[model samples]
Target: MLEHLKKEQINPSIIEEIKKYRQKYADTADTSQTSLRYLYYGKEIWEAAVHALLCGENLLLAGSKATGKNVLAENLARAFRRPCYNLSFHINMDASSMIGNDTFRNGEVVFRPGPIYQSAVDGGFCILDEINMARNEALAVLHSVLDFRRTIHIPGYDQIPVHPATRFIATMNYGYAGTRELNEALASRFVILQMPSITQDNLTRLLLREFPGIKKQFAEQFSGLFSDIEKKCESGELTEKVLDLRGLLDALRLIQNGLSPYPALDMGLTNKTFDAYEQTLIRDIITTRISKKTESTTIFS
Candidate 1:
């Protein structure tokens, strides 16, 4: 990962600091998962996030769908060589679920540690996924943990001080259903970075990275197809449901496995929306770049 950072031309000083941090917390490193599936492409975003984490400030990644917020979060954790604990926040998420809850075992009450608590104790990276989905009041428990105090206070248990290497990375997608604006107090606790939508160049790079045997022309066409769908979503002609990067990738994989392009795309992209009219629009967009008779063999070398 450090070598990849050098390839991206991240600041040398920042890279050095990251090395020092890893060395200092070498014992906290978890080697179970060594690499990220996808590498975030934007250099500026990478630099900003790396710098913020190096300064011991938590990060809040805010962006629209398919902007690589979670990808970057995982990449950051991998870059720092820390164990990552993911906590998906919803309406039912509360302090007890986050910090831990009391459970009876062997006729005795035992405190079961949650992701946040485990991450704090182990100096792991805790990913707060879709943080805005949870009510603000439920998040109040994080105030001291995120701020200068760096501690978690449980009423019946001893105070737990956050490990020096522990860092929280929260991701929120604006305008998502059931998601509300994050409260000011929680928002002010971390340095926020606005994630940008994946660019055509980066999309192409991602395809080539994931499928090295894929032909260059097909890669460009696939990425262009996604770009068209994104533009349509922005114009309100189609909902964001069709703008599925994962679906597109799955379609390509299906194509590689012998499915025809159109049917593969139908399973991957067009069928993501149940609306017939929207599916037609998506099919038209797909036809503009991909041939209906394009065979699976033609996609790869």
Candidate 2:
């Protein structure tokens, strides 16, 4: 399945550009405090990401929101020691926004290159984050870049050959509204990896790893709450918008800050989903499972 990477090798110049971009963004990309201790589900997803990257193939990571799709993308780039350029897609995104555009400057139409073009030319790894959110026309710009024939043509500019080391990793939360089906041409060009829901054991490990002194029983309860939410989401009873474990972690942090568990949990996790009824249900779940008191005697402290 990963045959295309070895078959169509990128040029040496493109590889050099990738190295340069890596150096340029070294100060900005922070992966240091990522709790490198990720779950088993994350490991397999990351392994597939690494496999695609090493083989020099563009990757499409398709999954629901808060499923750690972007996290795995960043982790893969860090693991490969590659520089990453993230381009967030939206409904208004355009080809010119991605490739490049021509504008008058000093009475001349100067070509201002976009992130995708710049990243391709520089040989850096470009992550098309939330790709499905954009219209198909906007994503059509990437067809040539993903194919064995390496080129990105923007009108009013030269046909720029993609950098050899420049591979694209696109992520999409399929359950999100206004997202389009990835075009078949585009899909056929790159490898696709479906990310799985994080497991309870891994969530427990993550909680323990991040909040070192938290009690085992407490962590188990929290993990179980997350599992229940996952089941709710899978069954279409709840929206993916409220499924962020990171939000739950933030709520826990707020609890440690003297905020009542009710208020903290409400502010950090449940309220993020936006539906009134769902929010209420989510709050009730947290209140029942997590503590409602804000006393300083936390499970960890």
Candidate 3:
């Protein structure tokens, strides 16, 4: 598969990393068994990111959390063989943290570069993770960096030009509390792509690919459980407890470790959310589903 990918002009570095991770984990296979494979519903988003990388356009990924925005961003970076530096956005983030900061030198104040500055100079990919969570003041510093003439200006220091290979990918979970909306000036700097919830087929493929040896019947049941949780979330019947496919995968692994499915599911998945009532309801739903599946399995076995 690595060889085939290489023939398609895919980055050798990315192909090498994929092979390296697979070998290190001893999980190499022709197909992925992870549930996230089926969760990819935004083909446009994926393709648009790819186009941006090829065309060297900075990108912005906007969606609700757990819709695979960051995952896709990382995957695209891996696929492109571009080194990625993730700048985690937070409320207190400042221009110095992104562009550069002044520091005491041997005998005077010197400019110490930040992740954004380094990535810009290094010609690597910069993932501005959760850009919306950042203060407008912080993002205001990015305006020049993202505009047509790619350059970042630090008031007290030299003006730096970004590398031709440098591309910026910003991701955000809109309407998520604690995040402010993107201001127009900053918003105009990026090409927006909306990410959607994972589709069932993709989710199933991801599970099967991630857990190659897991029983297919169980994989189907797990996928259905995720769908059920999603439905509950849409109906406002549950919190965001069910969006982590990794949690579900771990819960199943725990069951295989001799923990009863109910308890395993609770500890691995439901317990992640703090709402007692919501947690109990999720636990009950998982337990009922597992019982039904187990009974059917027993009859067949």
- TM-scores of all candidate predictions against the true structure: 0.93, 0.77, 0.76
- Global lDDT of each candidate: 0.92, 0.73, 0.71
Ranking by lDDT: 1, 2, 3
How do the residues 149-173 of candidate 1 rate in per-residue lDDT, one tens digit apiece?
9999998888999999999999998
| Residue-level lDDT tens digits of model 3 in 1-301 | 3333443455555556555543443422213323223223344555556666666678898887677777777666555445567899999999989988889989998888887898788666789999888888778889889998799998876799996667799998765457678889988888888777777666766677666666777777778888888888889998665566668778766666556666677777888888889887887777766773453223122
Write down the lDDT that model 3 would get: 0.71
Candidates ranked, most accurate by TM-score first: 1, 2, 3
Clashing residue pairs found in predicted model 1? none
Choose 1 or 2, whichever is better by lDDT. Answer: 1
The number of the candidate with the highest TM-score is: 1
lDDT of 1 at 272: 90
Number of the top-ranking candidate, with lDDT as the measure: 1
